[model samples]
Target: MTSAEAVPFRFFSLQVVRTRRLGPSLVRITFAGPELRDFRSDGLDQSLSLFLPHPGQDEPMVPIELGEDWWRGWMELPEDVRAVMRSYTLRELRRDADGATTEIDIDFVLHGVEPDAAVPAGPASRWAAQASAGDRVRLIGPSAADNRSIRFRPPEDTDLVLIWADETAVPAASAILESLPPGTRAVAWLEAHHAEEAQKLSVAADADLVWLVSDDGAPAAIDAVRAAQLPDAERPYVWIAGESGRMKELRRHFVNERGVDRRRVTFVGYWRQGLTEEQLREQGE
Candidate 1:
């Protein structure tokens, strides 16, 4: 919420225009609709709530209106009819030369959900794995005129940038990297479960990217962040996202071990190792 201006949340009905497999685990779903023109996404780490349909359901159920009290209205709906709401980062946004938004891209992490799995799949991942063109869903996004969900806040006169992200945070990290101003100095350490998930990243800043594949039985993700050598600067900003426990470790390393100002570090827990997102929300995480 630091970068974008204030705007009331708006409801938009979006349909899948295409789907692409970015890697072994990342599925890029492009959504398009007339309402998308009204959706304002201020690049870095912009997130929105998606109302995805439950399994075997034909359509997503959304409230008639979005207002300041939208959560109360959503809670009033029957659980069975209500859509499965989830938070995701806006990976990319495309606009025409005339300044009209055309398409929005979201990258969904497809955690291994085998057909004969012992447990059920998460609703959002299940939807992404099986979704196709013309499939519709709903979203609570920002208005074109104003937005407030982008939370990457670098202090004035930022000199050094450091980042740590797991698979879940890769899309946001990638978008942030693309938004860096030329001559910005950055270092990113990415943790991936498999080698294929480690990707070639493009950044405008002078960045050093280290991809850590854990399937080879390497050290913990936090250890990787701890071992990396950060570029020295007068004012360094740290952005980190990953599993909850890992994020805590990285935050401590930056703030306590390295003596970085606590306010300059932004850490978000995209998920936990054992807990589901619902559980995370219930505990007020």
Candidate 2:
């Protein structure tokens, strides 16, 4: 929760307080710690680096004592002893009466956890699936309210908001929807595996939501978005997140096909197909 003057990010020692099943593929875990009182974030899509322990370990092993050198120190540790780090979006944060953050929620996608899964669940997914009260973990997150890690930034002149997200980015997309000012115009397309995954989203903005469920044999993302007529907007902001391949495809559709300005489009590759997070990092993707 504390950071050096030069660094806006720091390590937080947290323990799981509870978990709720959001859907067949999503779980929401709430974490809290005394240090969390220092957590500050104004961004709806705040990014966090979570460190998790291996099975049988009591807590994640991160070299936080090294301070600014923590990353290098952690990288030098034995692979089996070092923590498993994964990126996630902060779904929500609660504040005390004094405006100090008290607790935070992170929604996890429980991919490949079913018995009939094609790929096995990775360390982070496995950990989240089994997380419970008192399960210890570490996080490297912003200590400042406004930092670069928060990516959902729409220009002040934006008149329309366009969003598309896959299951991995649903938590962030949902948060953005909830944060929009009243009467703001927004359109969002969310992709899910089953109808049960289409949770009710609350928003003050005048939004049109399209849920594409694979189980229901919904049209492909490009085709659906291409066929629809968007509301008239002079300055539109596009935000997209999901698998790397699909994200790129959508970006092209908006910029090249729809004639949206590339500068107004914000796209993030939350994950990639057929690649583990570790592998993606190793390849410097």
Q: For this target, which candidate reaches the highest TM-score against the unseen true structure?
A: 2
Clashing pairs in 1: none
Worst 10 residues of 1 by lDDT: 1-10
TM-score of every model?
0.89, 0.94
> How high a TM-score does candidate 2 get?
0.94
Candidate 1, residues 181-261, lDDT tens digits: the string is: 889999988777778777776777899988877776767777777777778898999999878888888899999989999
Clashes of each: 0, 0
Please give the range of 10 consecutive residues that has the lowest summed lDDT in model 2.
1-10
lDDT of each: 0.81, 0.90
Model 2: pairs clashing at backbone N, Cα or C within 3 Å: none
Candidate 2 CA-lDDT value: 0.90
